[model samples]
Target: MKRLSTLLLTASITASVMATGCIQPTGDAVSDAIPTAQDVRVNLPDSAGEAPAALGEVSEYYAMTRGITRGFNAGAGFVLVLVHAIVQMPPTTVDGNTYTWGPGSDPLDPADYRLTVIDNLDGTYDWSLDGKSKFDPNAEFLTAVSGLAVAGDEAHRGSGEFTLNFTNMKALDPIEHNDDGDGTITVIYDLENRDGTAASLEMHIDGTDENGQAVVADYAYAENQDGSGDFQFSLPADVDENGSALEDIILRSRWMADGSGRGDARISGGDAGDEVVEASQCWSTSFRTVYETSTHPEILPEAGDVSECAFADQDLPELPGV
Candidate 1:
């Protein structure tokens, strides 16, 4: 998926506003309550560059898992575009503790969408993206997206917790431009304490997939401060049409600072009639498979000694509440 340029546009506008002191502090509580874009943004890892010939042939499993990583990043990028659009734009009006942003003075403009940020006055802020209903000719603004962001200390700015609701985004957008699946994604992060060697990000997703199938998944990623990190996601049974005997499937990948990594996949309902199937493959710095093993020999036979693995079982990152 192509990356959205809205974030860059927001950054430029924010910088211009700050430089001109257009929205300077005026003892306005609601204006002061608006959080910066960084407070709510979750930055995902970028895709690895092309593998060099020196690493030999790339492992099929590595390529497959890498694709999944890219897909997750792309999905996240799409959701954040709206967040950036709302948080970075200057509010058009402030009433009591609520700040509003819209196209201009025209209420019946074709744009029709507006954003509101309300200060809870207790370190947490409520926000919503609303638009006029297409079905009703005289409808008021209806919330299409909503969320809450807990304000952190000066050092962290915005880090404790964040939640985003995309259930109505696509259905309620005047132009039907939203691509988010029907669901909510919650993120809990610690910027100060969780930086460097202890860096970590945990996200919980409860919603439907592209096929409108119910899905609940957990994503966890951690960086070792040395450019090495681990990524893992789990899909419970019946998430897809994987058959009646479906069970949870967990895929985990860990990479070193130099780009060498290993991917492990476990399938509970395999082709062999519900028997658990497990596979592990290790790739070189160039992404070439150097070692591979599978319990189902016909599916993914062993290719090299276990000793060839650069990482052991203990190196895998653990998922929360799994």
Candidate 2:
């Protein structure tokens, strides 16, 4: 996912195309209008000069598919791990010193929420997910990720493996199922900023249940499956000629797709060499919550499990170039 995201970040630089959402423009050609999830479902009809099709719903069709049980997750081509889990673990700053969960979020014991990740093979993905909320004991901020899968197209279908790194966040609240395994869900999380900008994940896969027991095909992070213009989105620290602090994540790669998907933010001065930053926008589509204290006990399967599982009704970004 990181690699794919990176490819998406980089894809902006080559050529631009307006994908459904998340667009960044360069000059006067750039319109002030940014695409949003709302624009697609509600506004598209009026704007297009024709009656809009009765699109099901924003979250309905827009839902991201992270599972790979169907195509590439099978044979030797690729083992795409599509993860769609919110980072529930909280982070804290005590006395000015930032404390990061060294390895992962520690158990407060009697964990109310329990998270489990299984694949198409009827087993677990053998990956550890948690929150790094240690510094601020009282206040909680967290991040979480879970089960991911992907399949290649008919021609280039193959298996590929990737890892997810949730940066700058808090703790992870695990998801527990009912008495039987049917209710057990990996993670259905959401997080966003005050502006309604955020992140959302929906992953799928097919593999074993127990950890380290599955045969996963790990593929190298390749840019633009079609050509070199594949790298889509990325965030980095600056390394200018004289060097400066890390800036925001600038939107690079072109919006058009040669298999290049539309990404959220970008890093300025990407061509400036070694310069990067986290975009100022709220790039996460998920909701905001303190996993443990969330509606459900620590973690419960499915968003509905949480009594107050509310996803923000924000608009999706527009890609001008594509």
Give the number of the best model, judged by lDDT: 1
Q: Where does the lowest 10-residue lDDT sum fall in candidate 1?
A: 103-112
lDDT at position 225, candidate 1:
54
Name model 2 segments beyond 4 Å from true. Answer: 1-145, 148-225, 249-251, 254-322
What local lDDT does model 1 show for residue 213?
A: 84
CA lDDT, every model vs. true structure: 0.57, 0.23
TM-score of the candidate numbered 1? 0.69
lDDT of 2 by residue, 118-205 (tens): 2233211232233333334663433233233222222112122223322221122122211111111222212121233322222222
Model 1 spans > 4 angstroms off = 1-55, 103-111, 120-123, 138-140, 152-157, 160-166, 174-181, 193-197, 209-212, 235-248, 314-322
Cα lDDT over the full model 1: 0.57
What is the per-residue lDDT of model 1 for residues 1-322, given as tens digits with 9 covering 90 to 100? 1243334323433443444323423243332344443432333334454454332667665665566556555554454465554454456567787866652212232325566777878976787656565466876665655666555444334444445555654444423334446777776554443444445566788988667888787877655656676778775433223365454567678877777778786756535356666768887676777787767775567776565565866333356653
Could you tell me which 10 consecutive residues in candidate 2 have the lowest summed lDDT?
A: 39-48
Clashing pairs in 1: none
